[model samples]
Target: MEYVFTLKYQLADEDRDHEQIVERLFEAGCDDATVGMGQPGRIALAFTRDAADAWSAIHSALQDARKAMPSARLVEAGPDFVGLTDVADLAGVTRQNMRKLMLAHASRFPLPVHEGSSSVWHLSDVLIWLSGRGSYPISAGLVDIAKATKQVNLAKEARQIEPRFNRQLVPLLA
Candidate 1:
């Protein structure tokens, strides 16, 4: 299986030079990725890697990235965060249609991670829903990758949770 995913990071000052960073990443086994340095202090690696499973593909890429730039902070693992338009585009439907589906199936629709004027959902959630609905032509590989990315991203973010605070917070959250 070939998993396609993007890992975005906040680069440390030591990793400032674009050319050197690219070289280092390549030497560290991220040759499978296309590195993008579009924003200052940030780098994005888009990878299309072959592995037996989606988790292995993303896990290896993340490990390779760590070897290349140990100081870089992982910012996001995407296609994990998306809006209705993004889901619609992936499904080859209009944004309005996607919204209508959500509205029509409000009870079964996956909850958005963030709710605002611009709501965002984990792509795997929407893809799964569409697959259940049938006739969406959604790719199983993409859904698998999305699920793996979402899990990886959540685990990364979970590092920030203070165990004592969580012990207190978890009860309050309910």
Candidate 2:
């Protein structure tokens, strides 16, 4: 299977040289990705990799990226965070219809990860919610990728939380 994803990293100051970064990435089995160096001190790799599963593709990409820049920190792995329009488009429904579904099933709809002017959600959460409702045209591969991305992003975020705080907070959240 070919999985498409983006991995963004915050480069260490010493590793910000574009030419060396690009060559290192390519040599580290990242020839499958197109490296983007837009924001200063940041790099984004948009990859279309062939692997047995989305997880494998993403995992290997992360390893390759790490190999290229050992000091780089992961910023995000995406197609995980999105809004109603994104979910609607993937599910083959209009945004209005998606809004209607959310409004109609306020009690059951997946909660947005962010709630404000424009909400955001973990793509897998919304997809799973729709899948439970009925037959939807959402692709299994997309859902798989969404799930993998969500996990990657969440794990990245988790590493930042202080262990003592996480230990205390875990039981409370549960």
Candidate 3:
């Protein structure tokens, strides 16, 4: 049986660079995927089961792509996190800028549940959030083979994106 891995993505105002977005998706193993129609910031990538499986092989591609850039953290789309980092790995930012953007974003994260005495985000929440772009500002990195089994609340959040369940991978956006 062939599985269609439909990758649906939304762009924030800051992510206006189409080249960058394409590069990121390509590195994420969406190369050769046919683009389905959507709003300007949103796109649907249709991939064959074989290509989707390559996700695991190219897991580290995102981090590798971001190696030269500072403040760039990986976002994931799967059952391994809530929202990941609050900070963007960009240059020429000041202390005040960091505090301003990051501070509010932390609280914006979905309520993390308690595992024992510690509060940790669940991979399940991350997956659900990815399924529904009801939660924005979520991100992930390319998959890492060595650490494929390991689930880091933030790291895995970047490497893999949770996909839509419906036949058409479009966000309800309500």
Candidate 4:
């Protein structure tokens, strides 16, 4: 037999809410449960269980949920902007595929936005696009530009570091 168990936890400082977080866990086999607020900013939760074996099942579910949400604290901030990258992330698609999906479903979506001569899409518009033909649930939230910028910077730094190692190793090999 299987049972569900929920553990309440506090959110971290740099996190935001992720709406699809819970549903994804539930879909992954989290048993009957509910989550809410407790002291100050802490979270409270309830889980159901029919046997002791359910503990492992519950832990697996929680781990999956944590991976999806990452930060409990920010799970409530919601998405702000829907960039092409963000759309790709939510749809579990590649950038090229996302563009394909958009183009293939253009007639289904509302007219693309034209801002300063370039086409743009509102977050809501993307949600509509997902609703029309997507199999997964769409969550609302904006791309964290600051985080994205940092990632780009980190990638650039890594490329710079790679040459230093290669240059030093090339002498050793010769």
Candidate 5:
């Protein structure tokens, strides 16, 4: 099984070389990792690993990153959830097509774990649904990466939203 996590780090300098830092993290065994600029002076790292060793993998990667950039401070880290975009990518369909399929086959679709502007499902649930459809050539590894990417984007968006507005939003799925 694969598990995904997103890590945000604060950079001491806003102008720090992000690509170089990400490359170093990659070299440290974060094979499925991607980095992006977060709020000013911050960087976001999203990665996936086997469920059996996710904690070890994340710990080692973060340690390596901290060693490489002494000023990098971990801000937040958590499990990455899958959204419609991830399912669309895994199924080789457009987001519109994915949404349409979900709506048309609502009873057959897995209930999302979270629902807001974009509903989010567990990666395993999406994969099982895709397998049942039997129309898409889906790979678990690819889906894991896509899920992590989607989660990272969601986290960024959440950070950008007003706290009051966000507080009023309730997830459809517990």
Candidate 6:
């Protein structure tokens, strides 16, 4: 099983190079970490780890990142989930084909955690099913990395949409 955490931080100043900070974080043992520039003076970091050791992995990564770069200040961090598009991409199939397979073999395929316009599932469940399918030319390591990347991207999209809608004013919003 794999777990993903998306973290946001504020850069100390313009002189603080974002790429350099990312490099340092990676060197500090964040092997599955990806970093991107967010708003001005802010950056986002995504980290992935096996579920069995996620708590320790994240704690260690945070400690190492802080030690390596004192100027970086953590803002928020949380887990992220993946959806059908992510599964299709990871399995090297079109979304339509993936959905077809799922529908045809509903007994074998795991049900999604959230079933709406875009169904969501835990990365581990998707990877486990994909690993058993001979059509997918993917390894365990690749699945872990891909799952992390997908979760991070999904979380970013959700964050981008949240600000545009007001929960009180839009009661029927999906």
Error of 1 at 166 (Å): 1.8
lDDT of 5: 0.69
For candidate 1, the per-residue lDDT at 91 reads 97
Which candidate tops TM-score?
A: 1
lDDT of 3 by residue, 1-174 (tens): 222333344555666666776676666555645654356766555544332333443343333324322233333332233223322222134536534643465665445645334344554443333335343343332222112322433444434545544323335522
**lDDT tens per residue, model 5, 1-174:** 666667778888743876787777777666676777867788877766665444455556667667666777666564445688877886789999999999999999988878889787776567767878887887665455445444544565677778776667655324
Question: RMSD (Cα, Å) of candidate 3?
Answer: 17.7
- Residues 93-128, candidate 4: write the lDDT tens digits: 787888787678777764553444445554455765
Model 2: per-residue Cα lDDT over 65-118, one tens digit each: 999999999998988999999989988999999999999999989888899989
- Pairing residues by index, what is the TM-score of model 3? 0.28
Per-candidate TM equals 0.95, 0.94, 0.28, 0.31, 0.49, 0.51
> What lDDT is reached at residue 159 by model 1?
92
Put the candidates in lDDT order, highest first. 1, 2, 5, 6, 4, 3
After TM-score superposition, what is the CA distance of residue 130 in candidate 4 from its true location, in Å? 0.8
| Candidate 6 residue pairs in clash (backbone atoms < 3 Å) | none
Report each candidate's C-alpha RMSD, comma-separated, in the order given.
1.3, 1.3, 17.7, 18.0, 6.9, 7.7
Candidate 6 accuracy as TM-score: 0.51
- Show where candidate 5 strays beyond 4 Å: 1-7, 11-38, 45-59, 66-79, 143-174
Which is superior by TM-score, 2 or 4? 2
* Candidate 1 vs 2: which has more TM-score: 1
CA shift at 146, candidate 3, in angstroms? Answer: 28
Query: What lDDT is obtained when candidate 6 is compared to the true structure?
Result: 0.68
The models' CA-based lDDT, in order, is: 0.93, 0.93, 0.41, 0.50, 0.69, 0.68
Candidate 2 residue 20 Cα shift, in angstroms, is: 1.6
Kindly list the per-residue Cα lDDT of model 1 for residues 18-60, writing each as its tens digit.
9998998999999999989889999999999999999899889
